[model samples]
Target: MYKKKYSNKFSVAPMLNYTDQYCRYFYRQLTKKTLLYTEMITSQELLYKNPDNYIRYTSNNQNPIAIQLAGNNINELTKCAMIAYSLGFNEINLNAGCPSKKAQLGGFGACLMLNPILLFNIIRAIYNTVPIPISIKIRLGTHNKNNYQHLYNFIKLVSKKNYCKRFIIHARIANLNGLNTKKNRCIPPLNYKYVYKIKKDFPNLKIILNGGIQNLQEAQKHLKIIDGVMLGRAIYKNPLMLCAVDQKIFSVHSIINKKILLDNMQKYIHYHSLKNIPIIYIFRHMLNIFYGKPQSKKLKQYFIHKIKNYTDITILFQKLSKKFNF
Candidate 1:
């Protein structure tokens, strides 16, 4: 369903605290083809957190969306995947890439790369229980260079056996040291050669390369070697890049005009305000959309701290439209 639904465009990474329904909806309004992903939800949290606040997704936000789960426990992960499938998600992705110490301490995330058997158990459980397809997002390995062989073995075991249909490689190794997530994203050099080798060895598996891929040119370059590409921080930082994705990567059948985006933002502002989620909570992402453009600073400043009311959001965007006129 995922491949057929969005076989042309690249995908937006599942950024934590950023790629929520609001961001997904806004991006979808800009382009029809780019596949958007949900923020990482830990298996334990999904089982224990109050669903009212933690697990939130609507069909209108992004229909072909994949829900990413962080966990190494087969039973818990499988249960979460089944729940996500029941909730109408088209695909369930295991988060084997996040390198946060907190995630590591929990015995999940990037730490799972060290134990392919454990990872395989989790993948197999999810694949067998849920009728929906399963995918994995992973880093090269944690702590050392030798882990790459095990990572490759893990991928081969899962992909060849059809435990999961796809694997999205982040193209870096987790340091598992004094580094923060931001540093983890950058400090670890991306190993594109290893990724190319993976594609070379596993010709039948669908490989999606991720990390440091910011624009269409870079994405097109990687697509020459991999089956797909996934965009991370860049998509959230500069959403207009998605417009280029439609034209350049997916070759979208039609273009979405700016008025439609603004209209949807207006509708969402009303909906979010009614939920009493302060307008700024939602508008914070829009600042990144206009970044690097004229008057962006002024608009960002206007709304950053003062979206107490819906009118504040309205006036702020109206002011930006008037000044920038994009």
Candidate 2:
């Protein structure tokens, strides 16, 4: 119920195009406790573009949520953090862990892992500007240089500012030169041992593990060793994965059945539909609701062939819900 509790439990990764406001709201509907995150918003986009667009929401999710930022400029980051804080974000997470060419060329992401002082400056400025918690999402190391000490020292330098209280570590090294964003995520092997060592060394630090975690059982296994687990593609592909998260991990039996969940989505779709926003933008996030269940393939076919407008989608959903008894 408290904001601080969110900082300690399971969270969804701040993925671009995957964890936008609509997606966050949908996930929040399934589980109220797991901390949701915004997609990586660059400081430049907020500074040069309309600051309101990136952080805008129809209604805030009931659970605590955080906004992750990608940039190297101290002042811009501070301003962006302040803007996000005003929008009611519970935490501001710095991106020192992404390995995309865009992130590297833009002077943020895993590339910043090598430049601890600059990352420190950016995080410190944001920390001083906002009252909310500051966190850093990072990889173990970058470019095959997996020196365990370097990882330790990186955290030491960034946390020296005393504002960063939480750290989410992706248990893999980022390949800056040879890999693209997709490859960087999959090609690298996961070294959970190093992540465990981090918790062992910084016993006081809140270290959340990311990378290669899919099902609740795996998440529970990691939770035994670290403070939390951050799910990436798995939750996006099968969002209903979070339906059991509250009961299995947090030990609170969630009463969120399919009827209530889809009704909420219907309301959200109608709200956007009134604004003339393309319904597909929101419906695409809901396509996986029937994942791993009976009548799933049939429902997917209906979406592909039958969906067009809000009315069509809603009608089809109602029919499918009745057919599946969901």
Candidate 3:
């Protein structure tokens, strides 16, 4: 049912602390067809932390979404995948590409590439349990080595018996030491060839290219070689790009206006505010809505001031529309 409405050609990466329920709500208003990913949740968190707060979603036309989980334990990963499947998520993606310090300490993320068996077990466990598809996000290699053969072998071993259905490859090697995630993303050079080669080798496997793709043209170029494209900061920093992506790349014709985005967000803001959810949690994301528009800085300042006393902010959009002459 959900598959009929959503497309995965352009997916927003699972950025921690950035992609949340409130943020997803905002992005959905910009483009209905693009797949929205949840922030990285660990198997431990899904079982131990309050799962409702971690994986909440407001129903809408953007029905096809993926939940990204970071963990190496087979039982724990499987349990979390089943829960996500039960919650109506279309896909459960294992976080094999995250290079954060916290992720490394937890025995998950990009470091999973070093131990293929553990990764295989986790993937197998998730795929065996739920009918929902399983995907993996991975880097070319860890420890500063851009080895193609090793990456190919890792994918080969993991898919020895058709364990995973899709693989999202970030076109850079993850450095375990010395480089933080922010630096890792930019410092390491992107090698799109490895991802393309993977597609050539694994013809039946669905391969998605990620890293450094910022515009529709770049996405279109990569699509010629791979099955899909996944983007992170490029989309978050400038969300209007997704509107272009929906229309141009995927041929999805849901062009949402800025006013409509604000209108829809008002409903979400009201519901959450009544639940005592801090107004900043939702408004902080709105700060970048007008990326290149005039009076953006002024609007951001206005939101900062209003958040101080945002008890009745349902009409915040109306105020902005009138102030900007929208």
Candidate 4:
């Protein structure tokens, strides 16, 4: 499939520590047709290390998958973008919005906001080399809301070059001094109005709102105003929320059902285990699938620590399903 057809309008945000290969495979199974993204992989990590294990995506699924690359050096990031393109990713998202000390020290992530010129060049290089759609994911501002004008200017430059198809705005500021990344995700008040303003100003460019969106109702609200909405922590903790995505967002026939979803999860677990991924890596996220069901607390607690083998985890899941009459 080509570019426009891959943009599903609603997607699960790329969350670190949570959206790994196994997680994407499982999420793809549950959601059936939604776009899935790999967690942010630094260009340095991809080039200097073995990324095969990290960036694996099965061709059989043919799910619309995007790879997010974060780095500062223009040459390194461009090289990584080429690598991702060569690997057949439908889209490549540059991470300009992570609030972490390490990312700052690396001279990338939210810090890229400071050097929009360099970012422009990086985007230009990626666009020049890769035929896939290129996009930017960023926060509303780095330190002050007033910097939005600066962001708008960057978007103007990118759009003027016809290099960027979309801009995903995480409705929060990066507090470089006081807050950690998790706190940054929560402590900063989401100002969707700022995003709405961007949408109004740049009618030619697609503006995507991300962060703090929880359910389909909230997604519908944003979809009415912006081009798209991205779900992060909410989706990871409650992945079933995406089950209705095809019907709710894409206006497509829905193939997602509870039984089919579980079978899909089991299939991925088997595939991941064959690849030597630990059972806990797959089971840790599945525990949330049954979240809020009767006996969920007990089952979550049991699986959280009691899981020692794949067979035992499968048995416990079966027992929990029976206990909750699922």
lDDT of 2 by residue, 41-82 (tens): 899998898755457764356448888899988888898888
Query: lDDT tens digits, residues 1-326, model 3?
Result: 35454556789888988988888888877777778889999989999989775698855544678999998888888888888887888888999988998889998999898888989888877778998778899999997555889999999998878879689999999998879989989998899989999999999998989999988898998898899999889887887677677788777676566667677778778888789888889878877766777888887798789778665676666776665422
Q: Write out the backbone clash pairs for model 2.
A: none
Candidate 3 collision pairs: none
Residue 31's lDDT in candidate 2: 90
Clash count list over all predictions: 0, 0, 0, 0
Task: Mark the regions of model 2 whose C-alpha exceeds 4 Å error after superposition.
Answer: 1-5, 51-53, 294-298, 309-314, 323-326
**Distance from true position, residue 283, model 3, in Å?**
1.6
Evaluate all candidate structures by whole-model CA lDDT and list the values in order. Answer: 0.78, 0.83, 0.83, 0.79
Model 2 TM-score, all chains together: 0.94
Which should have the higher lDDT, number 3 or number 4? Answer: 3
Clashing pairs in 1: none
TM-score for each of the candidates: 0.92, 0.94, 0.94, 0.92
Model 4 segments more than 4 A misplaced? 1-4, 144-147, 309-317, 320-326
